[model samples]
Target: MNEKVVVIYSGGMDSFTVLNRALKDGKQVYALSFDYGQRHVKELACAAKVCEELNVPHKVVDISAINQLLAGSSLTDDIEIPEGHYEEESMKSTVVPNRNMILLSLAVGYAVSVEASQVYYGAHSGDHAIYPDCRPEFVLKMNDVCKIANYDAVEIFSPYLEVSKTAILTDGLAMGLDYSNTWTCYNGREHACGKCGACVERLEAFRDNNTTDPLTYE
Candidate 1:
């Protein structure tokens, strides 16, 4: 039997790439999405659609109330999401405190319930500078914690940890993944706000790869 892996899928370019990679690796995939009351709940819809197309079982765990308590971050609150490259200092406002930790904790539990051996999420080098939870150290420590917390030994796998967004896009492209089905804008609109940090990074990635982003932007 192929090992089962649960993907913390957000229906963004990076997470969608992770999902496709797992499928290509012959793993039984279960997609896990969170409704954390983020401004970009639009990604959840895209996530479901992608899962449907892939014929993967998908579940959306509601932790939307976290937005009520963790209210300062731009993603979960009223603060304006900054526009610019992801390397900009202002983009730090977009970091939700302990977001990956919280999500991974929930994902680990789900993995255990499903008797899965691994949980995959997309936290690439691009996110390390601004988001503490996305750094390699955090992933290593979290994997250690998972080992101690679970009897069945679930592993946290981030294949893109040191990879660039452009490299991820290249991989997805090779797999024939449809980038149009993914959503990356933070604005939660019908069209992507091309100015937001997420959009900017995504656009740059495609441009660097000499390809066009399929999603229309405003």
Candidate 2:
């Protein structure tokens, strides 16, 4: 039997690559997506669609009740989503409080229940500047906690932890992955607001890869 693993899929480009990578490694992937009252439901919708096409077991966990607790960030609150380069200081407003920790903790619990020994999330080098939870130090500490949190000792796997968005896109492209299924915009509007940090970074990644983004942007 293939090794069982849990993937924290957000329907974004990074997580999309992580999910497919896990499957390519011959793991039985159980994908978990959090509906934490983010600014938009577009990513969640994209996640569901991709999972369905891949025939992967996917679950969308609703943790929206804690939206108020995780407020202050533009992702879950009233703050304006910043427009600029991804690494700009202004993008800091997009950080949801303790988001990765909360999501990883819940993912660990799901891993325990499913007898999966590993959990993967798509926190890449691009997020290290603005999102503290996505930093290498945070992931290292989270891995330690994940190992001892339960009797099974699940391992936290972040394959793209030290890699850039371009590298991730390159990997996905090598695998013949269609990025159209992914969503990276922070806004819920009909089209992606290309000015937002997320959109800017995504476009940069595609540019770096010498390719075009499949999603339409405003």
Candidate 3:
């Protein structure tokens, strides 16, 4: 039997690539998504659609009940989503409080339940500046905690932890992945707002690769 791996898929470009990478590596993948009341459900929908196309087992865990506790960010609160490059300080408003840790904890629990030895997420270097939870130090410490958190000892695997968004996109494009199935805009609009930080980074990735983004934008 192939090794079982649980991928924390968010239906965004980064996680989409991670999900396909697991399959490409010959692992039995369980794609896990969360409904954390991020102001939009399009990413979850995108995740489900991609998983369906790949015939991967996908589960959308409803954790929206905790949205109140995780509020304050533009993603979960009434604050306006920031626009422009992600490196700008204003983009900090978009960071959901302890979001990655919460997601990783749940993914680890799911991994244990499924007897999967690994849990993959899409925390990349680009996020380290704006999102504290995606930083290398956090990942390393969380990895340590995950090791002894339970007897099963599931590993927190993040292949793009140190790579840039451009590199991630490169890998996905190399794998012949169609990015239209992914969602990156911070808002839950019918068309991607090309001005938001998330969209900027994603567009930059495609531009850096000298390819056009398949997703339409406003």
Model 2 residue pairs with clashes: none
| Per-residue alpha-carbon lDDT of candidate 1 for residues 14-110, written as tens digits (9 for 90 to 100) | 9999999999999999999999989999999999998998899999989987776676899988899899988899998998988999999999999
lDDT of 2 by residue, 1-218 (tens): 99999999999989999999999999999999999988877899999999999999999999999986766888888778888987888888888889889999999999999999999989999998889999999999999998998899999999999999999999999999999999899998889999998898899999999999999988
lDDT of 3 by residue, 145-173 (tens): 99999999988999999999999999999
Count clashing pairs, candidate 2: 0
Query: In angstroms, how far off is 13's CA in candidate 2?
Result: 0.8
Give one clash count per candidate, in the order shown: 0, 0, 0
After superposition on all C-alphas, the RMSD of every candidate to the true structure, in Å, is 0.7, 0.8, 0.7
Error of 3 at 68 (Å): 1.9
TM-scores of all candidate predictions against the true structure: 0.98, 0.98, 0.98
Candidate 1 regions with alpha-carbon error over 4 angstroms: none
Q: Give the Cα-based TM-score of candidate 3 against the true structure.
A: 0.98
